[model samples]
Target chain A: MKSETVSTLLVEAASLLAIGMVFVFLFLALLIAAINLIAAFCRKFPGNFPAESSSVPLTKPLATPSRKIDDTTLAVIGAAVHQYRKQHQSNVKD
Target chain B: MDKFDVLWQSTALAHFTLGQMAMMLVGLLLLYLAIVKKFEPLLLLPIGFGALLTNIPLAGFSQAGGILFYIYEVGIDTGVFPLLIFMGVGAMTDFGALIANPRMLLLGAAAQFGIFATLFGAIALNWVPGFSFSLQDASAIAIIGGADGPTAIFLASKLAPELLGAIAVAAYSYMALVPIIQPPIMKALTTPEERKIEMEQLREVSQREKIIFPIAVLLLTILFLPAATPLVGMFCLGNLMRECGVVERLNKTAQNELINIVTIFLGLAVGSKLSADKFLTVETLGILALGAIAFGIGTATGVLMAKLMSRVSSRKINPLIGAAGVSAVPMAARVVNKVGLEANPHNFLLMHAMGPNVAGVLGSAVAAGVLLALVG
Candidate 1:
């Protein structure tokens, strides 16, 4: 209500601003240290991380497997088998 | 003659005041900004429409028995809606960038200079005969610098409900203007070389560390600043649900459905505050001016802090990312990235800027806590 109170409040605000900034920096600094520590620990004990088997396992992930036969190739293979079977049946019938 | 009299009485013309008409026009302007300009449309659209509804004379939309009134009573008045939104934000946020480069927290802290600086600015306006801002009023007004709408609304609801309309409007307006407000100051503070600097790529954070991060932050908050528990607590809850990878359902609800519902109610509640009597004051104009100044000062301080850090710290930080420390989330980060690209085509500062962007959220939350503890 008084001018004195108003001035006191402003003074308090200034102090709090300074204190708040320091706390923010300090709190985050601690978090930074914690993060760095965790990173170092993870690097040191990589085995503690989930094994490939425990997580997603891609077998021969980088390896290129032999190309599978195309539809045309499969059709050709089927036609040859059918022709051979038909000729053998004809011979038996003769 | 009696029938004509009843019709005239029923019409808006019979009940409208100059202030109400002006507020209605303002509401339409906000709608135009949201729909056509795509400025924070999710919020401004509803807020604008709510303003329109509230300004209608015969419709008791903002009165005791009205839907908007109940929404305000249950949510904004009790400060629940903002907390729910914070939780959603926490769920949606990825703190990995922040965790990987925790030092960006200093930029976040530096950006809050706008808040404290504007406190003095708001109080000093008392010298102008028509304006007088108490400490509580000043605290509520200054948080517009935080650039987080929910935090501003939360603090205003707690400290100064009367100014909620102007404060919320100013906060969101400045947040939407981040693309325009931050760049020139960011450019002025740093050399072209500093803007062009490329930061190192962040390390991959572990799932374990990600899961633990929110819990650790909550523990720290409880130990030091319990007043912030309402905001930080809900935020951490959302973040933990997201990171834990166990509560997919709860996380989905928090970040998406739950948040969407709360946003609608929150917008309308805020709009209800934009009544003709409340928003038509000289103080509202002062708030708008102070809000812009706060954002500019915040942008300037963040860049300066980065420049200071660059000299002392061994690691190189592109000062452009410092502007993202104002906590407008991905928008501020994108602005930094755009500015960085202009200086050096090869530099992509989005991910780097994100570190400070999220840290700014935490920093502002902490700053709000300090203000609440001291002033509220």
Candidate 2:
């Protein structure tokens, strides 16, 4: 009776091995097609659906000119640059 | 004298059995491995501690009303912890590599041959007098070949709760040993020229494709094999959250906080099953041996499959990356990269390996679903 049980289990396991491998292969094969189809669709309609703003664009320029700088802003920037250079020069001399 | 006697009888020392002592020693060995060797410390540490707690004489930690009992009941018994872990894994995984190269999915599929082949090994073990595994027990045992800890635990809990501890331990241990276990097989299968082969860079995948990939996977799984939906569904949900570029907070929580919490619970629950009666069996030896074989066969098949692909395709593929198809995640991929570098200093296969690494994850989940459908 015990040997009989083991034999049946071996048979069942053998069948499962065949069925499981085939299904897994078939399922993944279908997934590969589906993925390719999705890729093709996206290629056809690029950026039709933008990712949320949370995604920072990898290639975005570090700075963009949203508006022209005013004269006062430019003067402020020029003064900050002068001050920074003066401090660095003084430290190097020291 | 009477009061002293009562105190003595209540002490753990008084109730200790040889089995409990042996089990506690096993727990300490696990702790040593986790702390000293740092083998999957995240899960092994908690599991080791849980084993100690469960084996303490008169503690009843794994009994009806204990903390370990409740944790096991809430998480592993209900099969929630592994699913939650899968979600977090999904959230953390970047499908870009896979999306860039869909053909790598075949390597992933090829690796799952380990799981099914081990089913035969497990059933054949029944010929031994001490090992009489039911079809379900064999099924649970075979998943260890998947080399995926969560998938193994999930299937083991469902099909053979009694064997969960051995199966989980074997799965994680082999996964940790992938660096050691896979290299020799990888070396034996491929030639030096093949190992040094460099393929073209993967095309940049669009965010739109990433967003659609998980949904397509889930849809196919649901349509054809609803049984696998639980594992595949949660995985897709996590991936969708990651790729959709919305629900950043939810995605972050799933990736970090939620997964960590569940891993702790899952580890402990799995450890609770390591009590004396459940663990001290001849069957555990069979399980550990079988788990190692599963990994070896899976690695061999993956490498062989890649060799076949390399032969057919105009573009060359380094057969080493095929070993990553067993889904030890970045670890398996890194091993492939390291081996490839040895053959040719200029070759870098990390990104290429990641495609099959992640594919192996889905492949194992699908395989688990098949086992469940057929045997459960």
Candidate 3:
């Protein structure tokens, strides 16, 4: 359908359409700039940010002062860690 | 008898209406989005393919005893897909923020004002030339404002199966265009200061509370709106699986395999409804118009409700997050976050908006249930 053929209701909305699209384009351009900046910063600080290490499992924090570890509990925890490692390895493979 | 038979020999000829051709092309565009643009490919791709399949002349995929019709009977007409997907959604949702901030429920309710208002608008639009929307059809079209695709389809299948194709397509397409359609509305509704206002850090939520919250909510909704129990029940079940921490297997399946499979079948079944005879009329345009109006009203209501809450409380809330209360999931919430960042880069509204975001999903389902109860 031609733009002129659009109904009066839609024609009234044309101003909104124009204004919304302009803002969207500007937002995209700024997003691209920000991504480029991030890439540059990553290059500048090569090893400073440990993105991968932050998500590592925490086993050492509460255990040393909290309780005496039973063999069964230790085994269960060990099994959980082993499963996590396997899951992680498979994800990396994918 | 032989001479008569020779005179009336049938040759197979595919008959498709102009509207069917248009809808088929639109289906192809959806496929392009799914395959190339990679936009909601999991659901859109299957739906697009289904559209293509069912639109082919004499395919009978949607006819008596056919696969598409059978699937519709099992999943959609019975309202199974929406409830099952709700379960998956509940499993995936984190209700800590919502629990900590109960005020967001009002925003959720405010967003649904769009559904009822659009119902009236859609019914009114029938007065337009060539447009003839029944009460059921208008109600189906109006759910698009709720911005919940599954709920829209669920209600359409039950309340107005004839309009299902238009309603579902409009709902999903608008949802895909949320990032484009919503930011302007969000920006226009709130001032720079309101958008910039940073909320205090949400209080920490315990595992115990997380586990109990779903149960409490389920019980409450069941007692108050037994009509909504079906959806709320499935959702609570899904959440229970996730929070109980013992059903990782079920949780994984619900989120990944079950919802994905149902989405494909559901998409195709919905596409079947878009046959030329049903879709090409002025009613489709009215439906599209009503959908946009519904979304606008929903967004505006959410923002205005948030503004109201701000007046009553000392803790300043960014009214822009209310736009997320229309149940577009993370998409509407993400739009709120993006628009907020535009005004103030430091402001983050994603988690806070999630309270209303998920609530919008529930609210729409309840609204759908109400419509179904009254109109079914």
- Give the candidate number with the greatest DockQ: 2
lDDT of 1 by residue, B1-376 (tens): 9999999999999999898899999899989999999999989988998899888897888999988889999999999999999999999999889878888888998898888888888877766768878889998999999999999999999999999999988888888899898889999999988888998899887776677788878888898888888989999999988887767778889999999999999999999989989999999999999999989988999998999998899998888888889899889999999999999999999999999899889888988998898888
Single out the weakest 10-residue window by summed lDDT for candidate 3 chain B.
B5-14
Tens digits of per-residue lDDT for model 2, B1-376: 9999999999998999999899889889888989999999999999999999998877789899999999999999999999999999999999999888888988998999999899999899888889988889988999998888889999999999999999999999888899999999999999999999997899988878888899889889889899999999999999999888767788889999999999999999999999888899999999999999999999999999899999998888899989999998879999999999999999999999999999999999999999999899
Per-residue CA lDDT of model 3 for B90-183, tens digit only, reads 8887776776676676677678878877776665564455665565676688789889887888788778888888888889878888887877
TM-score list, all predictions: 0.89, 0.94, 0.76
- Candidate 1 per-residue lDDT, tens place, A1-94, comes to 4566667767766776687677777766776776667667766765544322213332457876659988998899999999999999999999
As for TM-score, the candidate ahead, 2 or 3, is: 2
Question: How many angstroms is residue B25 displaced in model 2 relative to the true structure, after the best TM-score fit?
Answer: 1.2
Query: What is the DockQ (computed on Cα atoms) for candidate 3?
Result: 0.02
Root-mean-square deviation per candidate: 5.9, 3.2, 13.9
Candidate 1 vs candidate 2, DockQ winner: 2
Per-residue CA lDDT of candidate 3, range A1-94, in tens? 3323334434323333343223322322332343334445544655533233323443356645646889999999999999999999999999
User: Could you tell me the lDDT of residue B271 within candidate 3?
Assistant: 70
On lDDT, the candidate that comes out on top is: 2
